[model samples]
Target: MSTRLRIALDAMGGDHAPDMVVDGADIARERCPNVDFLFVGDEQRINALLDARPALKAISQVRHTADVVAMDAKPSVALRSGRGSSMRLAIDAVASGEAASVVSAGNTGALMAMAKFVLKTLPGIDRPAIASMLPTMRGDCVMLDLGANLECDADNLVQFAVLGTVFAQTVLGLLEPTIGLLNVGSEEQKGHEAIRTAASALRATPLARNFHGFVEGTDIAAGTVDVVVTDGFTGNVALKTAEGTGKLFGEFLRRTFQSSLLAKLGYLLARTAFNKLRQRMDPRRYNGAMFLGLQGVCVKSHGGTDGLGFANAICVAVDLVQHGFNEKIRKELALLQESLQAASAAASGSDPQAVAQ
Candidate 1:
């Protein structure tokens, strides 16, 4: 059997459709020569795009499908009527073991719904969390529940922490990654009961050696922890706010530089430094958001990203597959379960027994 990784692509799902998807595949192919692709979309459109990239054509196969899920379609509607859609077909490829992973720049809700229905959650996981790497002061940090579960309980938060920890170790190559719960303050008494309970559980587990307690919003950029754990609601809001702040900062610098002749001349002198800053802040470098805790690998690319951004998403999938991400998660989760059960048993034993009447 061939050891090469095969990835399924939803070629008709993005704003730019087959063109961007095909071009991205070409870029990713160049980077990962051993990887093959199965493109699911309108065969004619995909072939037309591939005509210009003979190299990509040699490593890719097209699975024809004319149906596409609309960008604004409700998840329920897509689930009910999108059986033949490109996104669903691409996910099906993974479920059927035809591909190692699936990538799509499609409707977020529809993609998640379809993927969950098709691939199902990993054993011992109640829900899959959305995880992505963020550029931090120290380096990249993994954050989870990025708009996946809006209302998570203490167990869910703990589960997300385990998922994020495994991601950091597998993808980031960290030996012992530190984790933190995102809260308003770092004190033990702060935040909701769910977060506090999750914190206590983490501290009592094997993960406590690397757990950094609670961290605030500033800690995200400061890289206070290797992983940041939170509910989907807070994580989504934090991600958007950080994105907007970065854009605003860029705009402010642009206006400042163009304010006068002297400022423009100063900018020219610092052009190299500014270029490095631009590269560091480029969103394309971090375009892929992984659906962690799934039985199979699924990466969601930004719907409006360009070929380069989509290529990064493809790279994320390939890395997850090669690194044995899901297997690692399962092993870690099993250990976590054992530790929690043992702790529960100890607590029960310590409680006084009721007298027989």
Candidate 2:
């Protein structure tokens, strides 16, 4: 809290536009006293909302941008024509050092495209993967490549493990978080070649001690590992499935509680427990999805989320900034790169030093 962090908010990016964005910032202001906000959108609307919250307004500034990225905008088209859009300007703030991070509840693909183009990937990182936390029986689990790359090779998967590991350490406060590669089965011989190769590489490196190898889909909810790594296509599908399942479960519970007079009586008796369960499974608590591997922190909030959800996204950006998440990732990756070079040398029957060069 000693050093004030400036976070850029894409005021026109979300479904609710400046209203949700400003309300979210107000909530964030109460939680993070040392943080300042840069609201990028139409100055008039943003200021009008801020006027109602004098305390938040005191620590906020607005940058007028007439252009807004449509919720359904194509990533390709947005990248080509959204130069002065609110989302793009917010990202530019981070790249230009005007802000410590950028948060948006915008089109996921467009945000990813603009962020990658503006912030670029970290050194030794080929692509930035989408990472987010999932509520699990053992607390929370970190999963990556939620929807970044549709198809990834072995190397991409390897990098995702590294990214997920560092993220767990930084955010989850785990000294040695176990990692697993998502697959059809937990057997070593299962899954496609890319996943198997990635698993082998992870096991051969220093990360082997913390690597739990291949895990099935059920392992994700079971918290079989602290980090789950997979290609974007698979990871995205898993994420959506989990979301749908949560919704379906809630609906089933509602119907069961309303089935009959006996059921209604039972619901009253279990209301307290159900309340606790609802709090534990609140989607707002896990609204932020980080685009890891970018040079600057870029958090993507769910586009349709409410103010509370967006506020949680702001908190995520603050946590990453305070923890120096990118620095930790770079340090871990440096060590991993060295280990990989040594393994390559051993495979080729060459000197490790020469292979590194």
Residue 276, candidate 2: alpha-carbon lDDT = 95
Model 1: per-residue Cα lDDT at residue 273: 98
Candidate 1: the clashing residue pairs are: none
In the predicted model 2, the residue pairs found to clash are none
| Model 1 stretches with alpha carbons more than 4 Å out | 350-357
lDDT per residue for candidate 1 within 1-357, as digits (tens), equals: 667889999998889887889989989998987899999999998998888888888888999999999999999999999999999999999999999999999999899999999999988899999999999999999999999899999999999999999999988999999999999999999999999999999987889899999999999999999999999999999998999999999999999999999999999999999999999889999999999999999999999998999999999999999999999999999999888877876687742232222
lDDT for each residue of candidate 2 in 276-353, tens digit (9 for 90 to 100): 999889999989999999999999999998899999999999999999999998998899999998888888899677
Tell me how candidate 1 scores on lDDT: 0.93
State the local distance difference test value for candidate 2: 0.94
Q: What is the TM-score of each predicted model, taking all chains together?
A: 0.97, 0.97
